[model samples]
Target: AKYRINAFHELSERASQTYTTKQMTMEGVGEASRLGSKIINCKDVSYFWEGGCLLKEFSYNFQRFDKVEIVGRNGVGKSTFLDLLTGVLQPSSGVIERGESLVIGYYRQEGMDFTGDDTVLDIVGDTRLLGRFLFPHDMLNTRVSRLSGGEKRRLYLLTILMKNPNLLILDEPTNDLDIVTLNILEEYLKEYGGSLIIVSHDRHFLDRVVDHLLVFCGEGIVKDFIGSFSEYRSYMRDYESAKKKDSIASIKPQSSAKPEKKAEDKPRKLSFNQKRELESIESRLPELEEKKAAIEKDMNSGALPYDKLKEAAELFKQVSNEIDELETRWLELQN
Candidate 1:
């Protein structure tokens, strides 16, 4: 966060000769690419360190068109395995084998290497493509050092795509990106003709970008499940809920299993007014959610300007707050 300070040079720099031309295309991404027409397999992969092993026996058969997303609670070594896949870290015991043609474009969560004082135009030679990416003509002469944090991240993405890698690995890419940019990135990922491996907590983005998940269970175990992030969350919720119900049922008839509620603490029957309010909330919450989804659909198009996007995002936030309040109240009434 501290390193993203902007300190670009002004109009004194030469703008014409500094810029070069590069184009993004998917033409040559054939079987020759590292992400060729096959899967990159991890066979019983495990990573060890001085203190302890980070991951154990993780295996996944990742293939092109897989659009895999990895999910787990923090400190589960999601990033560690990404490093192993990228060859940055080695597994103590298992194997991570890449396809014959694998060109990986990795975007880490933070701290990208900025080699030198390359201007915005210098980094991306063609001004038109830069413009498409929201870099203005005047800003083209600005140094990469002068760009804002979000601007720098967007530029980093540009550089990555310019490499035309067939395998894309993006780790927590939505962290600093605004909603507008996130939506745009989602669209790009949808149309990208490459294999994708993303590690993110943004459920909306994951649902749109990834087709399945690699869930990390603790103690170095990883489970490969076929579904979107939302689907996985729903599954986990159901599992936890069922487990809780089973636990409650197991001890239900035991005399000393649990203390009974005091007479005054018993749940009261809903009053007429409370019942009316509950029904109203149940109806209103769906409307609010539907409105939020519509706003999200428009924002995802990335057609709004910064100011308009912020306005729409604020409205979306308000809708979300309303839904949350209504749901909370509804639960209270039910109790």
Candidate 2:
């Protein structure tokens, strides 16, 4: 009788434990369904510009994801879409639904302003939780007025992070960030558990961080693709090729209305200063490439100590900035 009673008690305990686990799982799923689904929902969304349609019947469902990237050419309403989602701008006509527990941290392309008299340290320190990934220093006393544009960008990122948000909406997050900070931010996002939606022109960064892509094309149409930037490009190329072939096959042969226009090619010309700038950029490119190669070598060989690696990484960032600046100047000269 004693043995039978003990067996019965063990079964009862097991049953109770299973019931508790099931209940907890059900509660978690309920919460996720309520809070993580449909982070940004738009149906028949439209926005108009002067005598033109910026967005026409754009619609998509952006749910919680590890990372999402928004891509498009300039003036395609990418920023406007973000603004509409964040309530910065009201849509002309559409319904947008945000989850109840969704808290958003937005980083705009332009700089953000902190309270006057706030020191860099104070601004950064106040956002320690978010800043820790990038700053990792006690900067509470550093005055914002003294901070550089890059520093300000970092601080803004930290401020958004400090809010402990469920969703992160970054607009051109890489615009002014140093390469080191950008890499650090990438690492953090890779490990972050919450949802992320970002707009960036940095192709490499998008390739590394985002698992999904949202493209805003003119005419109020948003395209969704479930892959990285490279994948999206590949898909786009294939689609265009197929479309071209189909069009060619469907066209009926007809006489040309006017003389066939010959494709004209012209020799490119550059001014003296422009040529010099291009030369300067070209000269610097190899040096940066060499430095990058050296860092990779050191990392591969395990010859760099932790401190040395960190220093090298910082130098790499500086070089990258110099390269970008030079390239930008060169492009302007070409234009």
Candidate 3:
């Protein structure tokens, strides 16, 4: 079917798209001696649990204005790393130095400690900020004990942001947040004036906010990658592919008579970036098809005016062309 072909085309095109680097600058306001350049420093930091090493030889001088995300599989000591950074848990071997003026606002995965008959307004005085977190004016008087689990989490997150700490550490921040609230949080963090350190499984949130990644590859290995989560994933894919090819090369029986190498002998391998692009494309193609289908339906309906019908037709054409180009690219990538 024509619709199916267009869908495939769009998928290919979306897969090839790349992300642009996000850069933002804020104007400095007032002379304040309350902040330091070096936020935290750890030298040869290592932690052990149940006679097994969790983190080892981790040394980094965390600076002011650094947006970092800690990424690893569950039970890989990501939260423990955060605990060590915040002084909740001490490293077994190394020293962690905290800044004198450092005021840390930590949002734990276990949620907030606030409990009792206190109203939401009583807990968070800022009604404007509360509304952004989906707490309406009528909801302000709602008691903390009466609020739902999600509501309680949102209120807790708002409380942390309100502290205006110079160093903000969030563990699993996106867990209880709705999509709209998550958007509001992302926007707030984009303009936030502090150094942000987060431990979250939300890939989109990480890619949107953090500038770099601290990837934990089990057994006390941490790779400090200078890019988004998607980029890091792409790099890993490419690295693994190269290793695989090398492995295949090593096991082959050596021929006493070497065959002549042809120009097209080696098969081209997809780079991690390309693989990521294809993944993104596959994710977006369905959405694009939906848009196209909507446009077609609009055009087919007799209720549209001449101008409106023309507009819908034009849009449909544009989408079709895009799908076609993307499909071509996709095929090329496959080959």
Q: Cα RMSDs of all predictions? A: 14.9, 15.7, 12.7
Sorted on lDDT, highest at the top, how do the candidates line up? 3, 1, 2
Tens digits of per-residue lDDT for model 3 on 18-118? 21233324314211125676678777788999988888887777765678888676677889999999989989998899998898889997858776789
Model 2: which ten-residue window has the lowest total lDDT? 1-10
lDDT of 3 at 49: 94
How much does candidate 1 score in TM-score?
0.67
Candidate 2 lDDT tens digits, 83-136? 888988887887777877778878887648777578766665454453555554
* Tens-digit per-residue lDDT, 1-335, candidate 1: 01111221211221111211121244343222445545467767788777676677665556556577876766768898889999988889988888777788888866465645888878877665577667888888888787788888888877777676788889888766766677668777776777788987555557787766676665675655567765654564454455546445555465653355322233334678886786687567658767888998888787989898889988876775576556445434432
- Pick the lDDT winner: 3
User: If candidate 3 were superposed on the true structure by all CA atoms, what would the RMSD be?
Assistant: 12.7
Considering summed lDDT, which 10 consecutive residues are worst modelled in model 3? Answer: 1-10
Backbone collisions counted per model? 8, 11, 5
Residue pairs whose backbone atoms clash in candidate 1: 7-146, 8-146, 20-125, 33-101, 34-101, 34-102, 35-101, 35-102
Q: After superposition, how far is residue 154 of candidate 1 from its true place, in Å?
A: 0.4
Cα-based lDDT for every prediction: 0.67, 0.63, 0.70
